[model samples]
Target: MMASVYDIWGAGFETTVATLQFAIIYLLNYPEVQRKLHEEMDGVIGREQELTMDDQKRLPYLCATIQEVQRASNVAPINFVRTTTEDIVVAGYLLRKGMNVIPQMPSLHLDDKLFPDPERFDPKRHLDKQGNFVKSDYVMPFSLGKRACMGESLARMELFLFLGTMVQKCEFQSVDKDAPPKIAVTP
Candidate 1:
């Protein structure tokens, strides 16, 4: 029990911090994206109003931006090794029961077929023409399946609250406006 607790705390802390840092860097690299996020946040959540998880639905652009950040950052490229309970065949490759396999999450996030010009940092991919947040199966930052991150819900709420509040209260900019730092998309 204690080991599981430690794993959750440590893993959650590391990933969240890395993701937030990458978010700031990405925002700096793309000021227009940051401006749009601010516009959405200010419009949905007024300057004085506090942000909550309930606001997530109303803030479509914010949601899309966060999703884009997760997709572009690829913070956790590989998930924990999961063993198959029974024999299975994936992509014509046979795997016997109890065979351990790791999911390469970046492959999905950076797939050109799924996300055209995958390297570019555009959040519109996660939004529909009507400006609604469109959740994608490919943007699995917290992994997927039964063995997915145990703290997935908690981490998501934290991210929504933290990122929402930060954008509401702050205006991030590059230290050198003339030459913005390049974003390192890899984890």
Candidate 2:
């Protein structure tokens, strides 16, 4: 029971906290993004009300920002190290059973071809020309597929709720805008 409990906390809660820290730091550094979140929340959900999953549809920029945070933070450095169950052809080479493979998440998240100007931290990247929140399969913060992180949906909901609520209530500010925090990319 204790081992299971610890696994849940270590795998999910800790990573979520780290991701949230990155988001808060980014919000502090980029006031414009913060303003956009505030505006969206106020316009769509209002200050007094709790934001729902339904409200997420109306807040494109905020949702994008959350995605950007997840991508940028790369909190879960190693996501579901996988092994082949049986012999399979992968892109030509045969991957036999017992061969271990891990997705290099940062490589995918920071790919210039997939995300133009990848280092800019621009949430607008996730937006379509129609100004809709478009999700990218490439943004695999919680990994992907059947063997992906167990807490993925829970993490996402937590991110939206906590971040939405916090931004709805308080404004984040940087004491020195010129010397904003330089968050390290976790390996």
Q: TM-scores of the models, in the given order?
A: 0.95, 0.91
State, as a TM-score between 0 and 1, how close model 1 is to the true structure: 0.95
TM-score of decoy 2: 0.91
Residue 77 Cα positional deviation in candidate 2, in Å, after optimal superposition? 2.1
> lDDT tens string, model 2, 61-145?
8899999998887887676678888899977999999999887798888889898877777899999999899998899997876
- Where does candidate 1 have its weakest 10-residue lDDT segment? 178-187
The true-structure Cα RMSD of candidate 2 reads 1.7
What are the per-residue Cα lDDT tens digits for candidate 1 across 54-119? 999999988888899999999999888999999999889999999999988898999999999999
Which clashing pairs does model 2 show? none
> Which residue pairs of candidate 1 clash?
none
- Candidate with best TM-score: 1
Where model 1 places Cα greater than 4 Å from the true spot, the runs are: none
lDDT of each: 0.90, 0.86
lDDT of 2: 0.86
